[model samples]
Target: MLYILFMIGLIWLGWKLIVFAIKATWGIAKVLLYIVCFPIILIGLVLGGLIYIALPILVVAGIIALLCGE
Candidate 1:
């Protein structure tokens, strides 16, 4: 019947639209993670390393200054 054929076509169109929407949203999420999240994570790692290196040197210098003063 013609009505059944029309219904099938409508369902197929709806399915295609949903697939396109999901793909678009996934692509946007990937771009956001790469452009924004990645840099923030990298900066955090660099800062963490800097702090880890600097704190020990600062403590050592303080100890030397205290021992030499007295």
Candidate 2:
């Protein structure tokens, strides 16, 4: 019985750790996306003459980032 309880606790903690790792990875990914990828994408779009499509999307993203403070 003690072994079973120990195993259960270990599994629970392992699951929690996995979830935390996924969240951290996602947060890093988003930060990199906004900081690095967006600017490159904008440059690509402008050079490709898709500003009409990219402009509003960038504006909305800017608003969201400003309001969310992230």
Candidate 3:
């Protein structure tokens, strides 16, 4: 019947709209992770290494100088 065909067409259109929305959201998430989150994480890691390694060495040197008192 024409009614049944109309119902089917509506369902198909609804399904396509839902799929399009999901794909759009997924694409946005991918772009944010790649462009924003990844570089921030990489910069944080590099700064963390400098703080962990160089900071302690400088502190120890300062303490030794203070104790020895030139």
User: Best by TM-score, which number?
Assistant: 2
Candidate 2 lDDT over residue span 22-56, tens digit each: 99999999989978999999989989999997899
Candidate numbers, best lDDT first, in rank order:
2, 1, 3
Residue 69, candidate 3: C-alpha displacement in angstroms: 58
TM-score of each: 0.64, 0.77, 0.63
Relative to the true structure, candidate 3 has a C-alpha RMSD (angstroms) of 15.8
The full ranking of all candidates by TM-score, starting with the best, is: 2, 1, 3
Give the backbone clash total of model 1: 0
**Model 3 bad stretches (over 4 Å):** 50-70
lDDT of 3 by residue, 11-59 (tens): 9999999999999999999989867985676567668875575556556
Residue 9 deviation, candidate 2, in Å?
Answer: 0.8
Residue ranges of candidate 2 with Cα displaced over 4 Å: none
Question: What is candidate 1's lDDT per residue for 1-70, written digit by digit as tens?
Answer: 9999999999999999999999999999998986788567656766887767566655675798689966
Which pairs clash inside model 1?
Answer: none
Q: Count the backbone clashes (under 3 Å) in each candidate.
A: 0, 0, 0
lDDT of each: 0.80, 0.94, 0.80
